[model samples]
Target: MRFLRNALLALAACAFAARPAMAQEILRDTESEALLQDMAAPIVKAAGFQPGAIDIVLLNDPSINAFVAGGQAIYIHSGLIETADNANEVQGVIAHEMGHITGGHVIRSSEGMADASRISILSLLLGAVAVAAGSAEAGMGAIMAGQRAALGKFLAFTRVQESSADAAGAKFLSDAGISGRGSIAFFDKLMGEEIRHGISQDDDEQFVRTHPMTGDRMSRLRDVYSKDPAWNTPVDPQLQSRFVLMKAKLEGYLATPEATLRDYPLSRDDEAALYARAYAYHKDARMDQAIAETDALLSREPDNPYFLELKGQVLLESGRPDEALESLRRANELTRNSPLIAAIFGHALIATEDPAHYDEARQVLRAAVARDRDNPFAWYQLGVVYAAQGDEPRARLASAEQQILSREYARALMSARAAESALPKDTPDWLRAQDIRMQAEAELERSRDRR
Candidate 1:
């Protein structure tokens, strides 16, 4: 389990950060990602941005943080979702982040340089903290102690940007027909925490450090929202229900088994509780109990793709690859061929270790990788299929693709070079091999320079 966790952490690094040294670990959960999209899409459109213009990135960090970096992308911490009571609170945050993007705050800042690697989460957070501290010097002092006042001014510019974002975000929420109450309440709660922590002078929490809490900002939010009719509107009950279910699933996977069980005892007996308990049991390696709980979920919503996906995932991990196929296949069908499910299904096929399944595994995995090019696991499985078929060059190319996605540049370089030498010259595969070789070499050079 630890090995799997570590490998997942390694693969979590996103391809968006193409710079070899600037990889950001991302969590890829279809349900969570889909929910985030659903919440953000309307607010994003309301903010006068094209739907395809912005991208949402989920981080596995437990910290309650979210920021915009790399221009259009929003990086949200898992802790934010787990801690928020409802979807509106998170949607509110997304709306604000979108404001940053829409207000041109992200692109206008020095952090949002033309180079993707320069647009970092660290810079965004530091800018926010600087704004909160209300001192250009204090903000720069934390990182660059001896810089001139100009650098301080540069960092301090974030205050105006933050204020603009707050106003813009409020308008977006109203326009989207969502109550800004969630945004206001969220800030109110954060301010309360800041006060409690300030009383002791032990320093502020990470959130407080990054997002400066001010009475004026809070008042502005309240004033703007109070005037809007949507301020009194309640969140959609259906959205609220989905939010609860998503939170329970996250808690189950992220929290300890005991903690999950304690929070979601059998007597609770709700679908969300059952889902949480199922994950807890899976983590504890109680296969029968886990499957039984999953069955309970499936029995309630027989055609639900997520429940089927979970059951298939557990079965696959528990060494019942054949049994995993049915559920995963059904899930793939129901979900309109989700790349994640397809990838997992391909993995099950490969797990059987039968040469007869290799051809089908290769086809399925190829389709999965085609859909999600950043999926290193799918690429790895495709390489396995290729190797099983005695196609060394294709295997090496796929292996190189996997290593590149995993940010193992040295290994990728070697594999790409091997593929390059063995494949037909000037062909698509050879050209791809050349591209990998160049990227990997450049990455390796950067690493050496860092040393």
Candidate 2:
């Protein structure tokens, strides 16, 4: 409910508020994530990267922006998705970011980040020392200076990369057989905003601050869309429908219940409307209404895995884990064992507290982790089950795996070392222990160097 998690891989773990306060927080929603992946698949492949290789992260911020960070991952704001009229708009944004990745823009930027990190550490340390000495002005100045320098280095990209990404993104959409009209439309929207508000030297919006607009940029995009055959193509109806449903769900979860009702009134009779209302009801603890809405969806699409997953989640979260089991089990079966769903299923099984079900829970969690190594929740749950079964060494190793995936390097190293000492040498578990210990140690060294 709160979030899952990597060393750096875990840096992007389930939605967490970035320390030192960089952004609102990250979020993890399986349904929304599935929609994003569906839209991004063709675009990522067109950009010459395996779709699975690029992680799509949903940020909780309500700002219209998208960017690549920490390598290979695309972070898109929930506001952008909610604001988009259709799947193509979101996909266009994704393609553009992918263009940056394929263009090696992020890699080029990392060189500056390395230097910036050092400067940031030094400045922060000096600031802390000054503050300890009661020199408030000096401390604040040092902190501000460091932040400005780091930001300057980080944002030193030219308009050239932006333009090139625009062109490359359009090509990717065209090659992938998706219309470039959405991309053009989005740029047009941004251009209109720029015209109305006028450019600010210090615009607060990340997108506006980073992406400079120019007549040439606008003309280039228009040219790309105007001449392309797919320019006028409509988004796939199924994809558009899914996008609508996804947006509705986000509104239900992220917005106030009254706001959700106003936006998705009961007067509206659609699958998406019902789905949104279900989440709203669930959020408000009106279980009867929530269950009714979920059942309505189930009546229409009995085998819809997402609906079933939602039903299971609602029941589990509502303290009816026993009742949740059937829905979750069926959902997992229907979806071919989605790790996210399985993780939840495993949770339900563990919550039942039936000793008879412990092995089954372990089995389910093991399968889930095997399929998705980045799922910290699954790893953590697996650790719990191991501990419950009196498998101390294995439990510690599982804990280490979860910690490592969570970027808790020092804690992970201690657990891994303990597991290694307790477990047999050269065995698979021992070998994994060795691997985690080494990785944790390396990360610890890097962390020290940064300080």
Candidate 3:
């Protein structure tokens, strides 16, 4: 379970499967994800981490929360995303998580997790610590779950790490062209709210009880925010859009399409709200409505990557593969190195009538897999494409890899057997996975000769 969950994390939050075909559900929409990319760019560049590998995901629980688990991914609860009013407040949170990763908080702390069937529970426990160490913790139960004595005596140690992250995060913001107030003001907001909300709800953590949010600290932070060198740079425009898109997506997911449509900007002029309602319509399978909404949106923002991607998706679902391809191709061009776009393109190629398009589909999926080795959709699609290409050996290999990603090792063995039948008798990659595959010819020959 740790192995599987960790795989998704390493892949930058592609998904997690609690059941077959229902695997890791992407929590946020493409727009918010793109916004997170914008928020992540400067901090990652400053920290020298791989850009695009670190994404911010919103969990659905309403309790104010944000966390970073699985090394490179940041998880923010939808509650937190909706709770923050402006971009800098959110960037402040991003900076804190960046602090944790930059300071080696994850590697130093997570070296101790053990494997068991209860690995999911353990990973949850350990993952919380890693997230806290990463310099951001919100959501319900984070503080208590992490600081619990049963968990460890680690929070005291983690507090030092947190302080270091706070200092480093401030520096990261200064270097990344954002203000310290993005960081300071965010803490201030939490502190400010806690004063009004006051005291734990039945579900709230006890750790927050002892970790007081003092007026003096907030005042000092405000003073620092005013004098901080980083405040001159405004929040990125893209981040603001993502903020709206995330709220809109979460709102759509939690509520009704009627609610979304009813609230959609009264004007035909509001593209952002229009796009949101289109997604809501798509979710509702009101295909004509969704297509109409997207068409109007595309008319206004022909080059907008998010709108183009949505239009392509609507086209595909509406059974217009040819049109989907054109729109998807444009979307792909607008976003560099996006696995989601590649996967959509792969689907487009495979659906087309051209026989040679299978290879094109394979290549696009391969690119997606290369970008995120853990994206099961890319690996699964590649396996299908390779099989269609009559490259049973490669298809088998892809199948096995996908199985590994999805925790279906038994089926992986089946794929390996079919693949090995078509390949040269031996290869190193095949040999490494030999124990897990069906018995092959050389092994059979060795058994017969020994007998």
Candidate 4:
């Protein structure tokens, strides 16, 4: 889990330095990302996006919501994944969010707001005219009526957009040759939640809500899906299997150990159960039990990089860095040096406290950051390597990298300046340090302007 504040949001935070800004919590896991990417690729392409053009980001929030904030990204809450029965269900949600992107709804939302504002302003004018005529009660009533009307108008616009996205999603699924059964099933789950919460599906409530009634959406989607040729198609078995494991993995990581044990007991020795129990045991600080569970997984699939990564993580966190290195090194190799896993491997190498390992750590950490510069943790580890080697200039440059990502623009600017002064001019390191200094200065200026 990491906190990612957008650069613009970070600047805004700096502008309001008197109050603490809420950071957006992101869950970045290589295994989960790979699965999500594979699941979203076809839907993305079907929605007219190139492969890798659309990103599916997982948020740490436990709310059953998936939305497109802007651009070509879909943010899926952890709760949505937890609630979903299969990958197909998530795919259905992704397709729907893609509809919002393709329709430019986020950009067009200003139109709805403007339309509502016009009604509100006109109503205020009318109310003022009544007030001037000495009818105080009538003026108040007019003002209140205008507010309600504006709200209703805005909500109606949103509802229309929602319905349009639903139709677009259905078409995307059809074009992708994916089954819509999972989509309908997921809607049924949402409908159940609405009933459980006693949320009325009456006409009046529907008029005020931003979305149409859950039941109405399901009904409309069902009709459209039923007529599609892919309606009866089965989900890919491999994808379904991965989803089950992913869900279990999330449960183990997020749930209390007691709850995880209750849900997946020792008696259940399936791969998913083992994966869950491994994490649960690790969280409970039961080293022997954690290792045993991990060993069970390794026995089943020795070459599995994710399992190896997990084993390495457990070992490293338990202060057995030496024992962790072999597993982590192999995992990194297996994944072709995946940035996230390699970062861990680099950290483990540093944890060994062996000066002999510092060179290898430096190499690994450099490569990790090269592949994924957004990873502050990797940059931190790389800084550790540079500092350990007595390379002050490079160390400051690394610190600048980590600080910039962490939104510490002031500190980053200082570090970058120090690094640029010490490093030889025209060198790559010197150039990167200069870049950071300029970037930090620009962000600081933006923050000042906002203030």
What TM-score does each of the candidates earn? 0.83, 0.80, 0.71, 0.93
**Candidate 4 on 1-451: residue-level lDDT in tens?**
0111132233222211112112457889999999999998888889888988987888877768877665677788899999999888998998888888899887777677677777777888899999999998898898878877877777778888889999999999999999999999999988888888988878668885778888889999999999999999999899998899999899989999999999999889999999999999999999889999999999999999999999999999999999999999999999999999999999999999999999999999999998899999999999998999999999999999999999999999999999999999999999999999999999999999999
lDDT of 3 by residue, 1-451 (tens): 4443353233222111112123224463556677777877887777777787686765656656565554677777666766787778777777777777777765654432222123346545666666767745442254344324323333234445556666677667777878766666667667667767874433235232222233444465566566777667676676776666666656655657887777675474476577768878898998888888878877887897877888888888777777788888788778874887888878877777566788778878988888777677778888788878887778788877787666575677677776666666668656634644743334445657999
lDDT of each: 0.78, 0.80, 0.65, 0.87
Which parts of model 4 are misplaced by more than 4 Å?
Answer: 1-22, 445-451
RMSD per candidate (Å) reads 9.2, 8.4, 11.0, 5.4
Least lDDT summed over 10 consecutive residues: which range in candidate 4? Answer: 13-22
Which candidate, 1 or 2, would have the higher lDDT against the true structure? 2
**TM-score winner among the candidates?**
4
Clashing residue pairs in candidate 3, if any?
15-24, 16-24, 17-23, 17-24, 64-139, 65-138, 65-139, 100-134, 179-230, 179-231
- Candidate 1 lDDT, 246-307, residue by residue in tens: 89999899899999999999899899999999999999999999999999999999998999
Clashes of each: 0, 3, 10, 0
TM-score of predicted structure 1:
0.83
Positional deviation of 302 in candidate 3, in angstroms?
A: 1.2
| Candidate 1 segments exceeding 4 Å error | 1-24, 111-155, 199-212
